[model samples]
Target chain A: MEKKDGCVKPSKGVIQTEETKSAAEPVQNGKETQKMLAKVGKPAPDFELSAFFEGGFKNVRLSDHKGKWIVVCFYPGDFTFV
Target chain B: MGVEVVAISTDSRFSHKIWQEEELSKMVDGGVPFPLLSDAGGRVGTVYGVYDEDAGVDIRGRFIIDPDFNIRAMEVLTPEVGRNVSELIRQVKAFQHVVETGEVTPSGWQPGKPTLTPGPDLAGKVWKEWKPEMAFD
Candidate 1:
């Protein structure tokens, strides 16, 4: 099994109670909505979705690739620029 | 020399078929060494952070990932403009070179060319050996 760091791994069955909801507060929130979303020097989020390939559509999951480079490029709507 | 290029666009398979049959097939006839992927549901775009939520479409985004699945570089171009394939190829080659040898590629660098040694004190060494025609100082 793949092992993750302790900070990212949450213990099982650790559910937040109602009291914890009110205690939690926003640490620091920014209001820059719709900003430049794509960023470099970060982990590219993996995904699996229906894609048309090899003359047919297939479900492609990101985890399907255990160790391989995946260049996921997203273009605008087909047949229309902008 | 072995790299996978996956191109995704928010379009139905039918539309993708039309594009391949009408336009891309011609490019393939000429020379297109890659396959085009159709993101019919736009989910892949959403995960890649390229989805235009209001417009319900994805912008132009390119991601370079290493064999270990770590993203090394990414570029998202404006919708009005297109990306430079030559520069993309150059970057892929440069990254491959760096992975093979501990070297840094200057801007506009090409393969089989000299590279900079990454160090604070070696700036002058890089600058002295740098070629202005490369468009990097």
Candidate 2:
């Protein structure tokens, strides 16, 4: 992928997980992974995860926020510098 | 501006609580004004293609999902650098403009700036309507 300003490409040495490995595989005989992975211009995969919100833990589902734009960010870990 | 922001990491909720209290609160007035999600085992990250199984963590990434749940933009980068919040907000505004006006935003486009109306007439004549210097201004 081409690197743009304020964005760096993931290292080539990074390991791909099993799910991604299967998803990345070239289609053969018209068979492909049934699971839908998040991609630009495609519907985001839905997920329900626990969250720490307002001094309490709560279950947050992506679909629950339908009809509103959502910005989902992921980081390596907590307590680490941004 | 009606966007819901959430952050996810492999850390547990307890860790998020402590981080918010001990670190984030000091930076922001009352800690980040968004939900700090805990993605155990990187399941959510796996679907987003940002999980690092060997490291047991999700690499730093961000996604802008439209109201319809379609991913309009995504940024994936290593942890060495922090993501730019201004750029993220800019793109969100640009997307919102396109959705409302059916006009395409040019590079570095901002609100009240020139937007191109997509059609055959504006195809090759883009330079006549917008100039490269306009992006910087």
Candidate 3:
């Protein structure tokens, strides 16, 4: 079982839901997901996050690609589920 | 015609770098065509609804955004399921075609395939507009 701690190593492509959705509310748990994002057919939420660049790190933002098509994918983690 | 592919995760940039160097070398022939954004604190993932609080990781999610920053298409998959890159490419191409030509592709549409224009007269005869060919796999 992968603990909810950020320090623990992740296994490849292993998926586990939360023990209780109640615990994740306000507290946030990785098991239960809330499908409430107002994204489809609307504007995407603009976000700026760090990214692995050419042998370095760079901040990437959603608004940066305003003039181009953007394919945004969110995977689990490195060396884990890709 | 221009598309920017950005991947994100809760992992730190250092972890992403190491993973790219060690594991992705074999999988990616030349290199990663796009930048892998690091959502280190899971803020972006939470907004995108792909964040899992239990495992402290993100589920597989794909969003196709157009040039005007509009969300054209999005898919959220379970952690166990892998995404189809070929299908994504096809969808991107489809979106591009529609934007350029104002025509919509039918089911199983691929490049060079016939498309449908939305109209009442062309509605019932959609079968006549598109002919199936054994081109796309």
Candidate 4:
């Protein structure tokens, strides 16, 4: 992917169909077997994953927060000294 | 400040619960004030290009996504170094400023600082309007 005019070009034509198919499943069990579609300067790849929030477990989808800025942080593991 | 934050890892929800209660809660009053997501088998991480298949974990990385769902900036680093929260906040503010106004921020630009208008006339004349020392001030 290349950055142009402050936006990254998205990889074309392969993400939509796969995303739609995955969306059909009510819950994703971390078994997503599709190609990576995320590119910097392009729409973030849609995802639905289980999350522990507010003392409870709930499913969180990336698309749910449309129209709001989001910060997605990835860490190696929990309880690590980092 | 109208931003939503989430942290993802290969750990299960159960593990997140323990860590939140035993560790994160001590760092902050009520622990991290955002969702602790479980990516389980690195499914989500793989899509973001941060998953380590061999290590079975996601590396340390962060992405700032705009309200339009477009990724504006991303940072990835090795485990030895911790990410800086101040820099993240600064970048977020810069992005918001650019979105609100069509001006681009200079390096280390903060709120209330002068911004540059993007155009051909402003290209070479940048040195006249903005100085190298301004970035440090």
TM-score of chain B taken alone, candidate 3: 0.88
Show model 4 residue runs off by greater than 4 Å: A1-35
Query: Per-prediction DockQ scores?
Result: 0.30, 0.40, 0.39, 0.45
lDDT of each: 0.63, 0.83, 0.75, 0.82
Q: Which window of 10 residues has the lowest lDDT sum in candidate 3 chain B?
A: B128-137
Give the Å shift of residue B67 in candidate 4: 0.8
Of candidate 3 chain A, the 10-residue stretch with the lowest lDDT total is A12-21
lDDT of predicted model 4:
0.82
- Which portions of model 2 show Cα errors greater than 4 Å? A1-36
Winner on lDDT (1 vs 3): 3
Please identify which of the two predictions, 1 or 2, would achieve the higher DockQ against the true structure.
2
lDDT at residue A78 of model 2 (Cα atoms): 95
Of models 2 and 4, which has the larger DockQ?
Answer: 4
Residue range B35-74, candidate 1, lDDT tens digits:
4565544555654667787777778999888776677888
The candidate with the higher TM-score, 3 or 4, is 4
DockQ of 3: 0.39
- Model 2 chain B is weakest, by summed lDDT over 10 consecutive residues, at B38-47
TM-score of chain A as modeled in candidate 4: 0.58
lDDT of 2 by residue, B1-137 (tens): 99999999988888898999999999999999999988877877877889988999999999999999899999999888999899999999999999998999998798889899999998899999988898784
- Candidate 4: tens digits of C-alpha lDDT, residues B1-137: 79999999988878898999999999999988999888877777877888888999989999999999999999988777899999999899999999999899998698899999989999789988888888784
